[model samples]
Structure formats: structure tokens, C-alpha cells
Target: MPGNDVRFLLVDDIRENLVALEALLRRDGLEIHTAQSAAQALELMLVNDYALAFLDVHMPETDGYELAELMRGAERTRRLPIIFVTAADMDETRRFRGYEAGAVDFIFKPIDPVILKSKSEVFFQLGCQARDLARQRDEMRAMALHRDQAMARLKAHADNSPLATVELDCDLNLRVWSQGAERIFGHKTRDMLGRPVAGTRWLSEETIHLLRGWIADDEGQDSAPRYTTEAIAFHAGGHEIACELYASSLCEPEGQHRSLTLQVLDISERRQAEAMRSLLIGELNHRIKNTLANVQAIARQTLRQSTGLEDFDRSFSGRLQALSRAHSILSDATWSSAPLDDLIADQIKAGTLDGDRLRQSGPKVQISPENMLRLALTLHELGTNAQKYGALSRSGGEVHLSWRCEGEGLVLQWQERGGPHVTPPVRTGFGHTLIGASAGGQDGSVDVDWQPEGVIWTIRLTQGVTPVSGDAPVQKALTSVTVTEESLVGRRILMIEDEPLVALDLTFELEDVGAEVVAVARTLRDALREAADQMVDLALLDGNLGGEKVDAVAEILSRRGIPFCFVSGYGPEHLPAGFRTVPIVQKPVDPARLLSVLHQISVTPVAETL
Candidate 1:
């Protein structure tokens, strides 16, 4: 079927003439509309966009000449092609009238079919061509509009991007500078555009040569689309920044270079982060090796002191736990220091004797993690002896523990009373050797008074003491203690660990030791909230919570006087500066070590926060 716009109009007074004219013009892809009068043809012309109009010269009311003149007067059909037909005799005057009335061509009645068809075909082909031309114009206009919109979007993306977008002419003169370029190099678009790139401090002479080489080399091959490289760029302030550059050249079809585009990305922060990661890895490696060596030392020492497998297991396990306890305290203080009182309480168990049988008196003191572990093991041996043969073995027995600062040194005393008669051991065991070694530290002294009533052990440690000035002795007298894991039993503990597996393992470990895990937190906000809870008795903290330091939480815990220890794979350097003295437990935790820390730092029921 023909398109509605491809219609042709035929008007005549006689039906035969109109039919003959329509049959001559009709063909595929063409529609013919017939009208018996000029009024009917005018109506059809107003409704349809006709390609051509054939008018009858001899009409009833309006002749072809008159109709053609009228058609030219109207805007819609003003440019429409018209052909006139008639049976009137030929004359110059009539022909002049027909030509003056806007007829493009004329045909007489009884016209030859060949002449009629040939003349109408010319108008038909012209109409088709004109229609195609109009459609092509519309399509080209739409395409132009789309191209403009796409360019606008591309420009917006380039201007807003963080990567520096730069365009330079073949002469290395800047042609374009985006907003990101201004931010990265600290030069405005106006200042950079049309300026020689070599004039800027951002790019070196060698870099300019390389950029030029890219354009020169691009003419040879099309394999490598983009050239990537790293370079040192200078900021406007004269400082150096690391940058990664991605460059590509734009050229004509004949390989003539038009311009070059360079995308610059600042990688200064990324480089710093990578360096820090390497440092941390090295430090971690060193710490791991040191820890393994220490563990080997403990195992060897325990083996030498053992009488059998059972003895080795008991001694080795106890020592490791004591070490772990010291670490836990240090971790709490971010591996800085441990308290003297906590270290003392960790070794002695209340259930080993009557609740009132033990007494403690000491001013608050802080010691290094190394010293804390040393003192803990020494006290553990002493407590073991008391439980086996001294005051702790009998219900009516009594023990008194006390410490005081003396001339840049510390004096710790252990006295037992109301037990079986006392006597010196036939052989010096590992326990006695450990206790004696405690005094050998810092050129200190040891004195054991084997009195008939019980025994008295005193040691003077000359090093690793930070005394609290004007702090009167804290005299703690605890009673009604339970028998099992009494130091940690019923204690409300707050735990902060980012790792889910570690937190779950630790929760079970604490619970197994009779400590109540009041709450567990994996983030800074949660840790702070739990730390502020008054019901919290103690805390175990992971030094780093997903790259953030737990300084604020530690501060809250310290201010509240709630005892806490740290668990970390990192050393003191990674710890919170303010809480460096807190105990630290290394990663790949030995449960015994954690248990030891809990026991060592436990406080009595009557103990107050401050």
C-alpha cells in the first residue's frame, strides 16, 4: 500500500476524463484521489498532503486555470505541482492564460496515452524524491540533537571526576584542563590552557620526553591503546606527590597526531599505606619468633624441673598460665605495665585456705610486663608450698601479704602462722630456686626465716617499680570465699574483640574459669557502652578494633577503676599510648595463659574500683 503522504489529486467535470487521468497515473506505491469539481479537489487538498494535482481546463463552475490560480493563493497547496487538461482548440492566448495560472504542464483532450503517462510519471518520481529528502532531513536533525546531549554528559563526567583529565596539542601546549587537574596540580584552567606543559613543575623534562615519545611511537603501531607509568610529581607548595599516569593519543585517519590525553591519579596515600603494612608485617614476624623462643625456654625449664610426665605437665602448664596472666594484664594496659596487687592475687587461691586466713596490704604499684610475670611465678610457688605443707594446709592457719616502696626499691613479705612446725627442706627444689631468683633481680636480697610456728619469706626487688606517691596501703580483708576458682568465680567480665571466632573462644574460656561474661562487643561504640556499665568487674580488650584504636574505651575503663587486660598479636608499639602499662596477651592464645591472667588480676569481693 502507498503511504498517505504520497497521494495525487485528479479533478474533472466528466467522470470519463477523471477515470482516464487516474488510470494513467496509478501505479505501485502511489494513491490517486478523484474529484468531479474544484470544490471537492480543494477539500481533498486541505485534508491530504498531495504530491501532485491534475485539473480539468473546462469545468462546470471553476475551470482548471481558475482552480490553479486559487491553489497558488492558499498556503497549504501553494507549492503543490499542478497539471491542466482540456479539449479546447490550441491558441497562444489560451496557452498564455494556462501558463499564467500556475500550470507546470498541460495536456489536451483525446490525449495520447504515452504522452499523458510520460508527463504524469515525471511528477510521480519527483514527489517520491522530495518525500525521501524531507525524511532524511528530519533524521539528520535528531542525530545532531543526540550527539549534542551525549557530549554534554561526557563533559560533565570529565569535569567532576577525581582523576586529572588533561589534553595537550602536538606541540605540548595545554588545550584542556579539567577541575580535577586544577585540584591535583594546583593550577587553574585559565592558567594552564594554551601554556606549555614543560613550564609546570609537576612534570619533569624526562617525563615530557616520554610523553612526546608516546605520540611519536603511536604512529607506528595500534596494538597498545594506552600507556601506563608511575612518576613523581611536585605540588604547588613544592612537596612531592606520587602519581600514576594513563596516556593515550588522538590522531586523524592518516595517522597525523591531533592531541594527547593524560589521566593522572594521585597515589601518595596508597603508597604510605603499603609501607606501613610492610613495617607491621616485619614487626609481627619478629614478635612471633621472640614469643616462640620464650615458649621454648619455658618448656625446657619445666622439663628440667619435672620428675615425670605428670610433673612436667603440671609445672609447664602452670608456668605458661602465669606468663599468659601477665600478658593479659599488660594487654589490658596495652602491654605497658601490670599492677603489683593483681600480680599477687593471681597466684594465691582463697579456697586453698579459710576465707579469713589470708590478709593483704599494699600501696598501689605498677611494674613492667616482664617483672610482673617474674613475680607471679615466684608467688605461685610460694602459694603452692603453703597449700602443701605450711599455713594453707590447716583450717586454723593464717597468711599475711604486704608490700612497701623502699628507696627506689620494693619490699614484699609473705608470712605464715598457726600451722605444723616449720623446717628447712632437705633439697632445694625448683620452687625455692625460683623464689630466690626473684631477689637476685636488680641486686636485691632474699631472707627466709624458718621459725618453729611456720615460715616467713621476704624479697627485695630493686628494679621495675613505679610507686604511687602518698598512696596509703589498701588493706583488703576478704571472707566467705568459695572453694573453686575463687579468684575469678562470680566475676562480671566485659569482653571487647573484633574477631568473631576469637571472641567466641574467649567467651567460653572465661565462662569455663567461673567468670561471668557480662557482655561482648566487637566495635568501639559497643565497647564504650559496656565499659561504662557499673556491673562490670573486669574487662578483656582487643587493642585494635578493625583498624581503629580502642583508646576511648580503655580510658573509660581506667577512669572507672575497672581492671582490664589486652589481647593482641601486636606489641607495645601498636598499643594505646595512654594505657601502655596495661597487661597484654598475645594472639594464638594459650587458655592457661588467659586463666593465669584472670587469676592474677582478680580482686576480692570487698574490693572497690579506686
Candidate 2:
């Protein structure tokens, strides 16, 4: 829009002549103005530029020659092209007069239309070229300004960046060192510049040798060939730092290597942080496994101890809740050892002890996590018995619980008073076994005295307070299913179990009985693969494989005419409808019955065997 529009001038005494000229030169961008006299033309010329002007030579007042001379006299209009037009015959005097008046050319009328148009187009093209040159000049200035700003920004980034940049020449001499390099290496740029790279010791011996090998070999690479790798280097202050380096040649046009750039980034902090995180994660995993093993033990013992689901819900739930409380305290300390006071305080603070009726006094004794869990559970049981039957049941009752670490071991005494007469239980129970474990390791001992006035319990377990190495005792519940090794002889089993503990037990028991296990699948996909890909005989499938039902696996086995049964803790209805006759052994299954079922399915008549 700005570059369009060229102004034009036409000076003629006759209106017809002006109209004819305007029509010939008229175009979308040309703005042709007509003047009837030289005085009016002068007025138009004073206001605007004209790329080309057509002036009539003969006039009564101030002729074309005079007007052209006047335009040449003005500063702004001097470059304006004047073309003189005449109906008169060519004469030397007239041409001489026009040339003397600064006219560019003279045209004799009637005009040759082609020459007239061609002559005008030349001046128009010149005007466009002049405008383009001016625009180009302005653009070059803007580019220079931007280049300066960019250079300043690059300088600032290099100064503030954390990564080090070093330039080394072909002779292995440090040619340049950036401000970032100075900051990271704890050395000034002046101290590093022009120094020998090999002597710097920043590059390890192995890394230096690797770099040298790369440099010595000519791989005939393209422009900007480079190598990047991570290695360990020493800081200026004598500490190991992990650095990532990028090396490239600063070559000449002939393709000979001249120098290299080592863009070093320090990653020591990041790697250290990652290592610490990994250690913490591994510790957390170990603790979680321990907790899970404890839970498994509690579940089995609770089930064995209870009469029915209602009794289990009433009794076992409370016991597990007690264990959960102990876990919470340990978890708060990141499963590390907690003080003895906090261990015992957790039960009483959780409403086991009436705030006004319990008295506690013990020197601060630090207990390991393994002993802490057992001790917490024991205190919980004692408090439960006290509230239900002993001292805490009565308003006038009280409990004085204390512990002191002596030369023999840490001795804990629990004494209760002012309650109904106490009677000894007929036989030992799970609660006694759990409390007994608190005194020492799994082999710890507990002593209980039932007096008419109240009850007294003494525990001895301090020497073996370190962390437990093996699993809980009740985890051995799976061993109750007994089978002779010869019972399952020559049986081929495919085990599909997701639970690791259950899988371990099944593998161990089945292998002990001389079964040749063909495959063990942990996922439904794996089960399907085993069914389709492997030779499976008498498959054992869990009801759930990682949260998904093993419907597809079951269908595959059934369709293949394979004798497969399910071993799960679920009801028979949980299985697919097609295999109604397939025996489903509920979990905690007797190994003898499982073996018997496999024996029955694998049996063949004498005629069929032949």
C-alpha cells in the first residue's frame, strides 16, 4: 500500500491535449493531474513529485520550455523528467531551445503511441528502483540492531549458565574458557586459557585415551562432526564430579581438524540424590515385605483360633487393629527403632488405659523395630485383658506397668489390682504365644501369675532385640496340608498363581511329591500362553490372576481336552460355567486331597493304558 501510487503531471494550454495524454498514460498506480496553464502547473509541481511530465511547447504565457526551466531551478523538482510535445515540424532552434531548458526528450505530434508509452515506462521503472534501494537501506539497519542485541543476550547466557564450555586447539592447549567453566571448575578463565589440556587432569586417563583415539582416526565425516559422552572428572578443589562433554572440531575450509569444544556439564549432585532415593526405596520395600509376612501370620492364626466368621470378625479384627496401631507408630519413624516409652505409650494413649488410673515409669530404653512390634502387641493384649476382666474394669482399679534393663536382660513387669477375683485359663492360646514372642526372639518366654487380688505378668527378652531375619511363625500354616513325596509321583502340573507366597508353597510342595511341573504362569496372558504353547497336564489355576478372572485360560484348557482344576480361596461359583465337573480345591487346601484329586484325574484303565 505504501509503495504504490506514482504522481504524474501534464501541462497543456488545450484541454483536449491534456485529456489525450492522461488517457495514454493512465494506469491503476498513476495519479495524472492536468493543468491548463504554466502558472497552474507550477502550483501542482510545488505540492507533489512527478515521475514523468508531458509539457506543450507553444503557449501564450510562460511556454513549456520556460516551465521546465522553472522546475529545474527548484530543489525537490530538479530530478523530475520533462518530455516536450509539439505539433510544429522539427526545427533545430526549437530542439535546441528545449534541450537548453533541461528537457529530457521532445516528442513530435501526432505521437507514435509505442514510443510515447515506452519512454514513459522507463522513468516509472527508475522510480520503483529508487524506492526499493531506500527500503533495502532501512532493512539493513534494522538487521544490524537485532544482531547487536542477540550478541548481548548470548554473552549473558554463557556467563550465567551452569554448564562449563572449554575450547582446546589441535595441540591440546586450552584456547578459550567461558565464565560458566570458571564457575563450575572453580578456576578463573585467565588461569585456564592457553594451558595444556593434557596436563589439566580434568579429563580422566580413560576418557583422554578414548578422545585421542577418536581424533587419531579419520572417519571422513561431514561438517560439524562431533562426539558426546559422560565421564567422571576431578574438580579444581579436588573432588570427583560427573561431567557430560561434547567434542567437535573447529576446522578450516580444507577439512583438517583444528580444535575441539568440550561442553562440560556437572551432574554429581543429581546422581548422588538419585542414589540416596534408590537406597530409601529398597529399605521401604524390605519393610513392606516384613509387614506383609506378619499380616499373613496373623490371618492364619486368627482363622485357626476362631469358631466362625462372626467370632473371627469380633476377635481377629481387634487383634489386627492392634497390629495396625503398632505399624502406624513404626511407620511414623520410617520403620526405624522407636524408644520404649513411645512403644508402650501408644496403646494407653489409644484409650486402652483410663487416663487417671494408669501409672507408668521407665528409664528411656531404645528398642529395635523387630522387638518394638512384638512389645506393642503384648501391651495391647495386656490392656485388653485388664479392661475386660482385670483392674481397668472396675472404677477403683489401677495398673502399674514398668520396665528396667538389668545385667541379665530388659525385664518388664505388668501388675494389676482392685478387680474381681482372677482365675487361670484352662489352656494356652494364640494371645499367650504372641505375648511370649515379645520377651526375646521367636523363642522368647513369658511368665503369668494368676492371683485372687489381681494378675502379674513378667517378660524376659532383650538380648535378641535386633531385627528379625526370618518370617513370622504363623506363615508356616501352609505346611498343615500334608502329602507324601510318593503320592504325586509322575504327575505333570501347570501352576497359575499370582501370589508369590502361595506360588512358592505350591512349587515346593508339588516338587517335593515328585511332580514334574510343566509350567507356572503368573498372569492370565501367561496362562493362556502356557495352555496354547506348552504341554500342560492337570493344570492348577487360581481364581484371580492379578485382579482379572482367568476365564480365557480356563476356556483354552477346557477346549484342549486338558484335565485342569482350580486351587483358590473362592467358592466354586466364581469359576466359569463350562467346567462344572472340574474339582475346585479351596485354599489352605489339604495337600493330601489335592494329590488324591490329581491321581484320580490322571488314572487310566488297564485296557486304556495298554
Candidate 3:
């Protein structure tokens, strides 16, 4: 009790000695607990922790020496301080034995209370200091652990970052260079580290002087060495590189001086991109100016060749606007490529149109800008021709456009109906030649079908006629054939879907087949819980549940001896490898088809389950 605080334990064979010891040591901030005999002391020790044990050496059954030996043997009281209270004069051997039994000091009977209080006070102070020291050590250790973690994270980021980085000291000595630095500079760390920065033949004297000045000003005068600077440095191969330098100080504990930390970054690729961007901007400006001049010349030529002012105005504005729309479509795709659907949409939207009289539907397909521009011009000519003499000129006419994949190519159909009857033109014009010749050059075939009801055209071309990549052809294979509801009767299922509506629909379908919906889960967490908690026979998992990967949930059910299937809107390629082995039911699923698959999976042995 006299350890951490000024609380003392008083033990004596006589009650008189305990009372005298308590009277002497009792103070404003001191606490004392007294025990009459060694047995009572040992009982107190078993129940509570004592800072010090004062014991009478002379006793009837068990003495202070024996109690001290027992205290040292018990784990709880082993480290406790014991002082012998004796009337007899103990020899050097007895004092040594008392110390061996874990006594801190010895006190004579008929004691001096002042000496007793003073000795107890010293032990209390020592205990308090020891506890404080232990707490400080724990705080230091926690701080050290936090610092280590921060340093490790910073090191990992620097090593893995794409940007090249290097560090140099104030004395122009190479200190640190990340893996990116080696990739960009083409210099090994072993060749550069601990070497003079100038030896690399990359750092210019001007750059070094600028760096030194910054370090001295920030680190010396202001006591803060943190700055960012950009310059040109040479790579190991002597190629000029754009670079940014960041410098900071590593100060010692005393804060008298500092070590410089220079973070060097190579931004050559960024600079090159900027230069190329400027060149592209200039090229675009030149093309635009030339196009504008060409439009002006075309307008002049059209006016000269026209039979009347109305004809001249109509022909000039229409052709120029068509050219403008083509240019706009090309610009939107960064002049790389454009979607075929998008090019057609832009052409139709920009040209004369009756929105209610036209409908367009097609599979998504991308086309190169070169092909798109020519295609746009062709479409514009066709739309203009229709407006002048075809269905578009009529009040209640309509045009329907659609496209579909045919083998390795695309077949686009343009049909006009609900218009005045049409007849074939006597002669082909410049517009017809432009549309025909342009498409022909791209391995495309166009057929103009002039019908009595309206005109129709069909264009067939390879999917990737342009310089754009085409999406993989979607293959819908019949994994299983349609089956009757009676085939699925009495089948059991474990439905795992996150959507409430989807789950309800699936349950209804299962019930329609005279089958049972054994269990349903809304999340991967819930699904896993159910798989472990329920007796699942068959599982139907949604491919994505609240953004969690459903494959893991499927794996859980599979491991638990359950047959499972995946339900997803995504294509087969979107699934993980070998996931195809697991049957996939595409969304907007047929109730009868789902029942058939569920029946198949329910009867399938767990050994064959995926």
C-alpha cells in the first residue's frame, strides 16, 4: 500500500504495536491497513495488493521470517517489500536471509515512530517514480510505432509512384533515388548513390546554384527548408528532361543545423505532351481556316452554275451546312473515330427534318473519322434529295432506319413510307455519284430500291470498315431447351438475389412450377449467413449484389455442397475465368426457362456443381 501512493500496510503480532505504528505514520494524505498476525496478513495479501508488509519477527505459530518466505513464494505478493519488526538483535546472516526472503528493511520492536514513517515515505516515493517511468516508456513506444508506420507508407508511395524522383543533399551529394528515377534517368542507384550530383553529368551549375540559394535562405535564415522549383535536367543519355525539385530540411533534435532533402522529379513526358498538344492545336486551326475558304469558293461556284437565285441559295447553304456537320462530328471524336449511329444522328439532326416523321434504331457501332466524314456527306445528300423529290417533301410521310449484324458485317436499311408515290430519276446527279463512289471505296455496297410506295436503300459493309475496333459478336447459345411446367414440379431451390422485386418474381416462378423457394438473401453477408445457417439444396445468385462480387458468395454455397447458378445482365466475358461452367441466366429471364434450369441444378449432384 506504501508503493504508488502514501498508503502503508501495518502488520504486527501485538495489536498495541499496530496501533502505535498507525498513530505515528498517519498524516493528511496517508492511508494505513493493519493486520494482527501473520495469518491475518497472509489473508489480506491474498485479497489485496500491498506496497509493503511490516511483520513481527517473534510470533506463536508463524513468525515474520516464515511469512516473508511464504510471501516470496506466492506470485501475487512475490515482489512486495517486507520489513522485519523484531525485539531481538538479528545477526548479519539473519539479515541476509531476511533479504533473500524479500525484505526491503528491518525495524526494531519498541520502535521510533519518526524513523518508521520516514522509511515508509521513501518506499512510497520510489514506487510512484517507478510507475511514472513505466507510463512514459509506454507513451514513447506508441509514438515510435506511429512514426514507423508513417515512414513505411511514405516509402511505399515513393517507390510505387509513376513519376521519377531523386533526392540530393545540400552538399550536392546524391542521397535518394526512387525506382522511377532509374526508369526515367537510366542510371542505377549503386552507380549514383553517395556520389557527387555533378558526376551524373545531368545537373547544370545554374540549377545547382539556384537549389543551394533556396536551401540556405529557407533552412538557414527561416529554419524551414521547404520549396518547389522546376527546371531542365539531362538524362543519363544526355537527353534534356523537364524536372521539378522539392527540398525540405531534416532537422536534428537540438535544431542547430539541418540536412537538406531534395525531391527531384522528371516531367519530360508531360512537357512532350504539351508540345504535341500545341502542334495539334495549330494543325486544327489550319484545317478550319482552309475548310472555311473552301466553303466560300464552293458557294461562289454554286451561284455561278445555278439556273436561278433560289436554286443558288438553296444548293450553297445546304452543301456548306452538311460539310459543317461532318466537321463537327469529326471534332467530337478528337478526329480519331466516331460511332456510325452518332454520325448518322448528327447528319440527320443538322439537316432539314420533320422529327415526328422519322425513326432511327441500330446496334452501337464505331467508325473511323475518315469513314464517318464521307458517310455523313453521303447521308446529307440522301436526306436533301428526299426533301426535294422523295417522301420527306410530303406532309404525312415517314422514314425508318435500322441496322443489324449480318455474319461479320453490318446491314443498314433506310426505308421511306406513307408518302406520295415515287418514280426513278432519269439521270444520276453529282450527289448520287458522291454517295455511291465514297461508300464503294470503303468496300461497302449500296442498293437504292425505288418503290411505288416510297424509296428504300440497303447498305452492307464489314463491321470494322473504318480504323476502329469492333465489339465481339454476341453469341446467344441455347444451353437448355424450353420445357413444360410439369417437368419442374416439386423442385427445391435456394434463391440468392439482392433485389426485392427480382427475388419475389423468381419465387413466384418457382411456386408456379409446384417448386419451393427454400431461402432468399438480399446481400453477400446475408447470403453467407444463410448458407451456414440454413439447409440449402440449390442456389441462384445475382451476379452483383450491392456492388459486392457475387462469385465469392457462389463459392461459399458451392463449398457447402449446394448447386448454384448466376443471374446477370452482363455478358459471359464479364464473368471470371471458369465461371462459365456455372450456368448463367441473363436478366429479363423467362419464368419457364428459369424453372427448367432450377430443376436441372436441384437434381445435379454436388460433385458436378460449379
Candidate 4:
């Protein structure tokens, strides 16, 4: 009700007196109803709610005191404030009777308007306060009803959700458990409710303790805290499963009485996917590293005794293209072998030998993967050599490339003519080694007859397993460069590589440049122990070791103040924050680039005595 609804009743046997009383007690927030007699006043009291009643003491049949008594008898108006105004000579006895008849106060015949109105105002204000209190109580009840309905809906939704929901009290004991929680943990709510989480074997001892600490402590945070982690959980039959937990505290908006809500999800499939992903990653890393090692070998061989970069670029690209073609064919064959014609066609395009100057006749034969790559590179090298000085150097020159099956084997020959005179190279280059390796298996041999008019090169292969080969032409020692001047001379290096071939290639490369490899580590464990125990000036590391990150090993090396570089197919983004400053080398490494990096970290001593 509005504040102006505070009503008052005025009564007297005289009409003018009733009007006078109404006017005297009038206020902006009060509605006054006047009556000239006790009967009309009683009727008004029954019809309307009133804050106070003003009545005259002297009346005909029933006086103001009697009406007040009547109001007091009825329960509805019993507490209403009543004030008596009278002209009769007043004494303490009459006042006592008025007070006993439920009169709150008395006014004399010549009423002091100030005292009447002030005293009347106090009762009006109390009635207003009482009304406001009752209204507030009703509104509070309504709001509480709505809040309960919303909570019921939320509880129903949470119970139906896939995530396991568990509620814990401030004492770290389970209070409420949902059906979803039972589904995940394999226990019914009846057995677990009101129980301490620490008592269950669902979580390990350490995890249980961790949870207790998290529940009781949020680092003194004033708001509800949240935490997420992956850990082990047990099934109803005692089988352990991987699960992720989302933990949080719930309470009022002001952050009181925090209760823990734990949501669990089964991560067994995700964990399995992660494991498979790791295995694939390791296998991919192995393939890439091995391929890179092969590339590295090819680079060394192609650049062997080269005079300049330009002189070697064409040779190296041609060799790499041949290797790519061989790989494409082998990949098509599922790494089994490559048809001999496919390789020849690849070289014909790569060597620019597709015109009349090139002629060929061959029966298709399947060469094993090892022999296929070597054969491709060997043919490429021969073509490049011929282009520079042999038959292809002259306008009238012609070349014949042919192969045929012989007694349980194959014979391939390249005959050149009508060009500059032919002569054998003084020292064996990459070409010689590649040809030798292509023919290295099972009585296979490569022969070059250098004649004045041309060169006749023949390669024979026996049918059997083509053995895996290693390295290009062995690097020649540089007598012109001394130990004191060599960049890596006397430097003890630690190598961490997961692939065997890549590791060996890197080690051989380092040894060729005068660096002493102190130890080789293939796993994080081995890397750490090696880093701690070995004495080395520098280290080489792979980004991943045995399917784990190398950052921990890198951290150890960093704390020891030993410099290192990462060499892996995994990129620089995979490097941890603390190790981002370190150098990185991707797979299929460029030999010159590797050399430059090695040189930057190698040990160089100046001649002090000289």
C-alpha cells in the first residue's frame, strides 16, 4: 500500500467537533474519515483500515471510551491507536479510566494542537513501519519460491549431463552426488554421500591429498577458484582409467560458504589417440631423419672437390632430382623397388638428354630401393660428367644408354662418341663412389674404359638382395688446414639424435671436421645423464627424444652453461621458452649450412707462441 493509505477515524456527538478533530490531525500522507456519533464511528472502523482513532469522552448512549472498548474486543482493530479528547473537568481518575479503556493519550477541552498532532504523528509512523515490514516479508517469500524453482531446474540439468558432478562441503567431505558421478566412478550416491573423499580409493593417495589442499586453499583468494588436471581414476571393478577433472568452488555472489564441484570426464579414448599420435610422430621422425641422412650423404658426394658454389649447384640439383624421382617410384611401389625404365625416363628429363643425342634400348627390370637410388644418382653423375667434357660437349656427339638381361643378372652400358678425347679422373669423385655402390651388391661391378674417341662404361648386377649402403665418397683430409686453425679441432661434442642413420651421419660429419664426439644420447634419460657426466664444449640435440620433448635435457644443458642446437623435423615453435634462444636445424640438412652452424660453435685456438 502507498504511504498515503494511512487512514484515521474521528468521532464526536457534535458535527463541528468531528470536523475540528479531522482538520487538526490532517497530514499529506493520511486520509481522515469523520463521524458525529459512536455508531457511525464504529461502522467506519469496520469498513476501513485505520492507523489511529480520535474520540470524544462524553456522548449520549455510548461514549468514546465505550467505542474504544468495542474496537479492543474485535481482533481486527484491537491494536489500533486511540486518543481521547474531552471538555469534562478532568482528573487523574478519569484519565486512569481512559487509559484502562485502551486510550493511548488524552487531550483537554482547549486542546493544544501542537501536542495532539505530534502525539498523533508517532502512532501514524509506527503503523506505516509495521505495514512496510509485512509487505517486505511477503515479497521475500515470493522471491525464495522462485529461487527454489530455478535451483531445481539446474539440479535436474546437472544430473542429466554427461560430466560427473560431485559436491563437497567446506570440510572436504562429499555432500551431494549426482547420477553422472556414479556412472563415471561406478559407485552409487548412497554409498558415497556424506563420506570424506580422502577415504575412497578412487583417487591415489597423492591426488587425494592434492584435492584436499585445493579445496581448503585457493592461495587466500577471495573468489571461488577453478582448477583442471588429468589424473588416474579407478573403476568399480578396480581397473584404472585416465580422466580429466574440472574442479571449482560454488557459493553466493559475495563469495560465502564455498562448496567444491568436481566434474570428471573419461579420457581413455583421448589418451589412446594421443599414444597413437606419438607413435606416428616417432615413425615419421625416423623416416624423415633417414631420408635427410641420405640427402646429406648425396650433398657431400655432389660437392666433393667442387671448385665453387655455381659449379656444384647444377650437379647437386640434378643429383637431388634423380633421388626424388627414385623416391617417387619407390613410394609408388610401396618402397619395394623401382622399374629400371622409370629411372631412365627420370634422368632423361633431368639431364636434358631427351633429344637425338640420347638413345636407349632396355628391358624393364625391377631394382631394389637401395640400388634404385644409387643407380639414379650414378646415371645422373655420368651424364653431368659427359656434358662437361665427354661426347655431349661436341655438336656431333651421340650417346647410347642400353641394358639387357644376362645369365641370372642384368648388364647396362653407356657408350659415348664423336666428342673431346676421354680421360680418367685423377682422384675418385662422388660419381665413382655412386657407380661403385650401385654395383656393390652380389658380384656387381662398374667398369669404365677410357678410349681416345669416347668412353665405354658398363655396370653389371646379380639377382639377389641389394644390401643397404652407407655414405658418399669419403671426404679427403685437408692437409692445407692445420689442427690449430681448424674450427672444430679439439672440441669435445655431445650428440643427441634418435635416428641411427642421422646420428651416424652427424657424427661422421663432425669427425671429418676434427670435432671429437664425446658421447651420443638417443633418449631424454641418456641425454640428461650424458649432459651431467660428459665434458664437452658444445652439444647437438634433436627436438624430440624417444617420443618426449628435449626441453628437460636442454634445461640441464642450459643450467650447466653448455651451448647446444636442436636438429629435428619438429619446428622451432615446439621449443620451450627457456630454450628458444638456442639454434635449430631442420631435417634434410644442407651440408654447407650445417658446416656454418658447427663453425659458429666450434673451438678455435690462436697461436700464442708464434
Clash count per candidate: 20, 1, 3, 0
lDDT of 3 by residue, 184-294 (tens): 778888888998777777678888788677656654444565778898888788888888977776655666334567667777778899999999999889877877776
Summed over model 2, clashes come to: 1
How would you encode candidate 4's per-residue C-alpha lDDT over 276-296 as one tens digit per residue? Answer: 899989977987797789778
Error of 4 at 88 (Å): 2.6
What digit string (tens of lDDT, one per residue) describes model 1 on residues 250-280? Answer: 8757677667899999899999999989998
lDDT of 2 by residue, 305-358 (tens): 778987665556566656666665666666676666666655654555564677
Q: How far is candidate 3 from the true structure (C-alpha RMSD, Å)?
A: 18.7
**TM per candidate:** 0.57, 0.49, 0.52, 0.40
What stretches of model 1 exceed 4 Å from their correct place? 4-7, 35-48, 57-76, 86-122, 145-164, 178-191, 222-225, 234-240, 301-312, 325-610
Q: After superposition, how far is residue 281 of candidate 2 from its true place, in Å?
A: 3.4
> Between 2 and 4, whose lDDT is larger?
4
lDDT of each: 0.79, 0.75, 0.72, 0.76
What's model 2's lDDT at 109?
Answer: 90
Could you say which candidate leads in TM-score? 1
- Model 4 off-target regions past 4 Å? 1-5, 36-48, 58-62, 91-97, 169-171, 182-190, 213-217, 235-242, 249-259, 266-610
Worst 10 residues of 4 by lDDT: 473-482
Residue 403 of model 4 has an lDDT of 75
**Selected candidate, larger TM-score, 1 vs 4:** 1
